[model samples]
Target: MSPLARKRLGRVALNAAGVAVFLFAVFPVYWMVATAFKPNDQIFTTSFIPFPDPPSMDHVSRVFTQGVAGNSIWRYLLNSTIVALSAVVIGAVFALLAATAVARFRFRFRTSFLILLLIVQMVPAEALLIPLFTMVKRLGLYDQLLGLIVINVGLTLPFSVWMLRTFVAAVPKELEEASWIDGAGRFTTFWRVLFPLVAPGLVATSIFSFITTWNEFVFALTLIGDQGKYTMPVALQFFVGQRSTDWGGIMAASTLMTIPVLIFFLLVQRRMVSGLVAGAVKG
Candidate 1:
């Protein structure tokens, strides 16, 4: 084969590999959605069907009507939303401030502080459950949504700070200097000049925090004592029983749980892409 032909063949192989990887990643999600709409009889049958022959809304309807664990399905969704949103908002603010400090200011123990943040991120959350639980209980935040929000913020904060510091540092110091020369106050410079550039990174971090908090299971399960206060992740467990699992209901609820994440990604995906690219170029 000529060199040009071999290069073309290699490109074709790469494209084929990319398509295969995409399909492998997407198949499970497609299956879940398909199964959610399948009738119980169809779902359990030996024959594999790519899509439901005649789709049914029975499972989805059951999830809404019958609810989960003595509370409406909406309640769990609301709890998850509240916790995720709260964590994202709180975590982002603190992360931004800390990032700003570390990125812009020189201080003693700065390296140590960054290292500590990394150490915290490296520590598995499961290992801290006992200490966190005791601390939450002592603070009288046990079994409350606030406790879960606080825990999520703490869990996500270190990574948020670490990720955001890079973005902050990537922002050209010349821009801030120019703003200062123009007599812009510190707050004005930050709000007007720095914020727009950092917004993408902030959005990316918020998405991460939101998704992490939304899908968080262990802390929600351990911290919350009230069944009614359970988030969607914990509530999904209601579909499982010792005798037989409600596969249909499980799939339906799982599908519902994924909608917010998809919506969030769609809303900010462009900014996220740009943010990542800009960070890479700047770094």
Candidate 2:
């Protein structure tokens, strides 16, 4: 084959591979959405039926109105929101301070501390569940959103700190030096000059913490046992019963649960590009 023809064929092959990977990644999400919208009878009737025939709102209405296995989904959603937001708030502050300290100072065990954070991230969360649950119970925090928040904040903090450290370290030291020359205090220099540069990183970290905590299930399930205290994921289990499963309601609930994360991503989408550029250029 001619070189030009081979190059064109290679381009087509690459495009096809890209499309295949995209579809593979997206298929599950599409199926979930499709299943949620499908009527009960239509679920297993045909794989090709991508949407509900009559396009009913019954499942959605049921999710809002009916208490699945005696659990209030809306209340659980509120619990999830409270836990996730609180975790993100507390995690971000701790991460910011820790990141700043690590980035600016040459302290003892600094390298070890960074390495420890990476190691912790490598450990599977499931392995720590039992121990964490026992600790939470001993502390009288079991079944409370406060306990969940505390655990999530701790879990997400290390990575957040590491990420922010990179972003902060990337900022020019000369900028801070110039600020000090102009008589800016340490706090002033950090807040005025460094904070703006790391703003993107902070936002990125917040999003990560929020999503991780929001979707977290194992910890939530083990820690919070009461139906009233359940987060969205735990509450979702109510849809499955020994006798039968409420496919429609499950889908509707799943769909509803996904909206907040989607909205959060959409809101931050504009900042994401700017944040990446800022962090990259400064670093």
Candidate 3:
């Protein structure tokens, strides 16, 4: 093979691999949406039906009108949204501060602290569930959205701190020195200089926190006692019975659960791109 021919062949192979990976990731999403609209016969037939013959909204209609577990589906959505957004906001603040300290300062046991965060992350959330439940109860936050928010923040904070530390450290100390020479105080220096550069990392971490909290099922299920307090993941349980499961309803609910995440990613992706360009221009 000539050099140019080999190069072209490699490019073609790379493109084909990219397309295959894309389909692998996206096929499940497409199947879920299709199943949501499929009629019972099409969904349950022995042979495969790739597409719904005539799309039906029976599941969607029933979800909206009948509600779940005697509460509106919208209520559960609102609960999940509240918990996810709150967790993201609270987690970002603490993570930013912690990352700054870790990346910027020298302190006793600093290395140990970083290692401890990793150790905490490696410990399964399920193993900590009972202890966390006890603590939440002691703190009088059980069965509240606040409890879920606090749990999520704790769960995501280690990763956020670790990820953002690199972004923070990538920023040069000379920038802060220059700001100090110009009479900018510590808070002003951070607000005017460091924070803008770190914004991209913050947005990236926020997306992770939001999606994790939104899709979290075990904590949400075990922490809250009230039916009305359930998040969307927990609310989906109502569609299942001992004898039979409501596949259409489950798929419909899952599709609905996926939309907010998609929209959030689209929004965050634009901001991340813009932030990167702005940081580059500033540099």
Candidate 4:
């Protein structure tokens, strides 16, 4: 084949692969959304229905009206928002400071500190549940939303520090030095020069932390005992029963649970894009 023809064929093949991957990732989400609007009769039907013939809001209505676990759905949403946001805020602060230290400063045991962060990341969160639970109880934080926030901050911190370190290191140290020469204090140099540049990595890590904490099932379930304090993930579990499951309700609740994450991404997407471009230019 001619070289141009081969190149064209390869481009076409890559486009097709991209489309396939997109569909593979999106189909399950589409199915869940479709099921949320489907009537009970259609949901259990033998044959496939690509779209609900006549969409129903019965499941969504039930979820809002009936609520979950003796509390309004809003309560659970609020709890989740509180915990996830708190964790993200706290985690981001610590991660940024730690990342800056590791990237900028020459200190003793720096290599060992970085290695320890990696080691913590490698440890499965599930394995630490027993010990964490015991510690939280001992500290009188068990069953409180604050405890969950603290746990999430701890859980996400090491990875955030590790990830943000790259962003910090990517920034030209010369910029900070220039700011200092211009009479900018250490705090001013960080806030004005470094923070804006590293914002992308911070947002990325915050999103990961938020999502991780928001959808976290094991810790939220184990740490919190009060129904009033249950987050969305835990609230969703109330839909399951021994004999049968409320699949429609589960789908509906899940759909609701996803909105905050989508909104968060939408709000930060522009900033994230700008941050990436800024980092590239600065680097």
Best by TM-score: 1
Candidate 2 residue-wise lDDT, 182-234, digit = tens: 99999999899999998987888799789889999999999987888888988
TM-score of 1: 0.88
Q: Which is superior by lDDT, 3 or 4? A: 4
* Candidate No. with top lDDT: 1
Extract clashing residue pairs from model 4.
Answer: none
Error of 1 at 93 (Å): 1.0
TM-score of each: 0.88, 0.87, 0.85, 0.86
Clashes of 1: 0
Worst 10 residues of 1 by lDDT: 270-279
Kindly list the per-residue Cα lDDT of model 4 for residues 1-283, writing each as its tens digit.
9999999999999999999999999999899999999999988889998997799999998888888788878889899999999999999999999999999999999999989987998899999999999999999998999999999999989878877788899899999999999999999999999999999778887986787889889999999999999999999999898888888999999999988787877767764554334446657
Which structure is stronger by lDDT: 1 or 3? 1
Residues 13-100, candidate 3: write the lDDT tens digits.
9999999999999999999999999988788779988887799998877777787788878889999999999999999999999999
Stronger candidate by TM-score (2 vs 3)? 2
Runs with alpha carbons beyond 4 Å of true place in candidate 2:
1-10, 44-47, 262-283
Question: Model 1: residues >4 Å from true position, as ranges?
Answer: 1-16, 263-283
Error of 2 at 86 (Å): 0.5
